[model samples]
Target: MLVLFLLGTSSSALAKGQKHTYWHLTSDAGEEAGKEFESQLRSVLVQAEGTHHTTEGSLAELLDQKPLKVPSCFEGAKLCTTVPELLVEALGVDGLVEGRISAAADGYQVELTLYREFGGTPKVVTRSGADLEGVVRDAVGALFTLEAAIKIYTEPAGASVFVNGNLVGESPTRVQVHEGNHGLRLEKEGYEVLREDLTVLPGEVREYNATLVPKVTQITVITWAESAAVYVDGKLSGASGAPIDVMPGAHSLELRANGYRPIEITFDIAAAQRRTIQLAMLKEVEDPWARREQAIRTYRLYVEAGYALTLQSIGFAGATADIAGSTYSPTSFGGEDRASLVFNGVKLAVGYTMERLGLVFLGVDLMVASMDSELILTAQDTARRESAVGQGASHIALYPLQGTFRELWGAFGAEAQTGLGVSFDSLNGDLTGDAFDLSQTAVFWSLAASGRYYLSEEWSLTLGYRMDYDFADQRGLRHGFFAGVGFNLPLLVDAGGESKDESLPEQLEEDVPVEGTDVPESTLQKLEQSGTEGGREP
Candidate 1:
């Protein structure tokens, strides 16, 4: 016979003990083993489906627009008296057909319905009674509902990224979530914040590699840039410092500068990590400031080799003129070193820099020639001797601006040095007799002003004009330009956490380290004396 013991459903996912909305059990067997079966079956079904008891009196009030928030099901919540009517509604039909078969037999069936007070119908599906325990066990495993792993990617490589208040990667648009429910968020500077709920599963790797349209959010950071645009996960985010929200995760960041070229980069993201976007632009001749700052320990030490166009010209009278009606034309010539190169063979520089009180550097530059040119002059008494003219070559030293120098938008350096040079020809036509040694160990003084722009951190070029007077009394001009390739051997000085004050009674004031005054006691005292000599210094 088709036995129908009891059938019911509720408006709430939870209820309190006997007060829970449900169909009371009754059958031809009266209230014997039938009651026991009903109790056992309800216990299993409610627990598995995450519907238990509610302490509230009104079921309708308890199951309003939302389910009651409960402890993590991972703790094995006991849901004996109530089951959500929503699950019952999911059957598509009207009610739920359920029953309990003796475990010693096969499976059981349970009948469940919704709004049965108005005679709602129920549907039936059959399964083993033992399977109920497994369903409950699996449902109570993980936390944060079911989530699937999210898989993300970007185009043109590196894109700044974040996910769910956590930083997973600098360029990874991908992530993971479980089945059930989740909150997903994505961000990159210059782009708008993107977010949505994510229903995930174990095998799913959700993709977030869509091009981010740029946005002009609540930030305005304009420094220097070129073809320079921003992107996050294949999307155009905005220009540098364009505010945008990001999920917590790993992501990539790229900064493009003007030129026939662009720049790209990658980095990590984590809670508490700085999320500011900025780009400092410069000529496309050397390293980008962003990259150079990473390896350069000392600014002056970074210049390894350079090329330039320099013009050194001097016009003189008083010497090549006769008291005649016309000026003498004794080899009249004036030209500039249109191009030249210099390589720093021996360079030394060092400094200590902190974010606070500015920066100070001390260094000297020693450069020998890679290529250079010069002019010379001489005189011969009344005789047609052509005098002795010297050529400047090799064995030279130059000192670039160091210590406290001038302040100009351009590069300026003072030059004064000693070197050995040699010249040929113009020794009064005396092909012999020291004529070849005319350009010998001479003193040369030069004052120069130059301009430079960098395309990247690795390469740069300069334009300079120098006026040099050699000891030969014959002064001529030479000018040229050169390209610079830089190499940096960095000495990293990571400030350790300020040493804590461990030596005192809490009432005593702690001694703070003085700025620019890191030295041994003796050295400090010596510096103090020097300061005393100069009134004071910070």
Candidate 2:
């Protein structure tokens, strides 16, 4: 019976050609019972597929030992003894099976341990029953045949799979695992890890389909302005300080806010990386009209001192004169005289300007003129008088309407102004050894056209031609050419007030936009090109 049983077991083992060894089975029941249990386990293992079984007696014979005394410490539930480094090589088997049998209250307790040649944690199974053979058979079957198949399929295949922290095959692949609890982990480049705990029963086939998520590059944009809108890859993402998720690649980022310059940049991101971008928006320059309006409304003081050459025509009325020994009545003596005089004057003005509206100037002008020439009193009288005359005038000057037509070069501009005021004029001199004293108060008006060359922000050279008419007893019409230096001092005032400086024409030329003004088309195209290139809304 023993020979026939060995032949029956060895027939399948020889055909399979895989080598597994029954190391030993020990028991406190007795040596005879231990031998019988070991023989039964060896016969059962040899009959099973996948591995040929080698008995401990045959393995000991190969080692030239009468009997093998495997250590008792190696037979316990815990691995209390160190395994030999060359134990598998010395045993000359693909795997080893070892067990311990102890007396239980029912009958016997069996513990089986399976160790493979490719070293790993050994699998152990424990069972107790009154039937010793049944208990041994069941424990061996649990250790050898109780396996589950897990078929792992990943969305993007080729992820490395780990079972119980040990690297298994890549998905989508099949792994044979011992029937129990298992920790499954899948890892792929640019994809999130998938981890799961699974419990499988004996001979169970589990289909585990895992959809691996791609790892995102976390992009955090922190902007100086909270109202700034953020964009990634030309898509509006969110506002400042919001986090964006993107694939690991090169991307374009942009930030835009009203009244601030827009920012754009490109950067590359890595997988599973966190990147932070900090930005500060630059404020755009105010509109030209806005700056012009602000500057126009600021209060200013103007002071100008100038020299004027004037040709004055004086009408003489109600004058008493003797003609050829005949006394002429005062009412009948009416004539005109002309004089060329040089005048030095100073003018002080305060004013303000409004856009689209005009400007106002309230000023005081003081002038003194001196003349040394022979003046004929009249053509009818035929009298030539060598006269030394001094004249002085003080005028309250007001200019209510002013307009600037254009700017000539960058530094030069022109304006036309008209004004009316009240003047006090005095003349006191010796006329051919006679006292000639006259005082006249009159209402005067003047029209002026001036050209300015700006020297600085507050200073300019002014040349102007003015015509003045006086309504008084001695009606005079004067044509004057004046040259002067003008100074403008801006008073720091809020925008609510209306104020203007004498330099407003220059300001308008540089800052303010006028209607019907011709701007170069290329300049406008450049401005539009820059705005479009920024990729931001106005």
What are the C-alpha RMSDs, in order, of all predicted structures? 25.5, 20.8
Using Cα atoms with residue i matched to residue i, what is each candidate's TM-score against the true structure?
0.22, 0.39
lDDT of each: 0.36, 0.58
Output the worst ten-in-a-row residue range by lDDT, candidate 1: 423-432
Per-residue lDDT over 375-482 for candidate 2, one digit per residue giving the tens place of the 0 to 100 score: 333323543332233333223334333332323444565756666767655544444465454445666777777787767546768888978787765567766777
Per-residue alpha-carbon lDDT of candidate 1 for residues 159-259, written as tens digits (9 for 90 to 100):
55555566666555555544456665566664556665666543334565656544532323233332357665556767654565554456665555443
- Per-residue error at 262 for model 1, in Å? 29
RMSD of model 1 against the true structure: 25.5
Model 2, residue 467: distance off in Å is 3.8
Backbone-clash count (model 1)? 90
Residue-pair clashes per prediction, in order, are 90, 2
* Candidate topping TM-score: 2
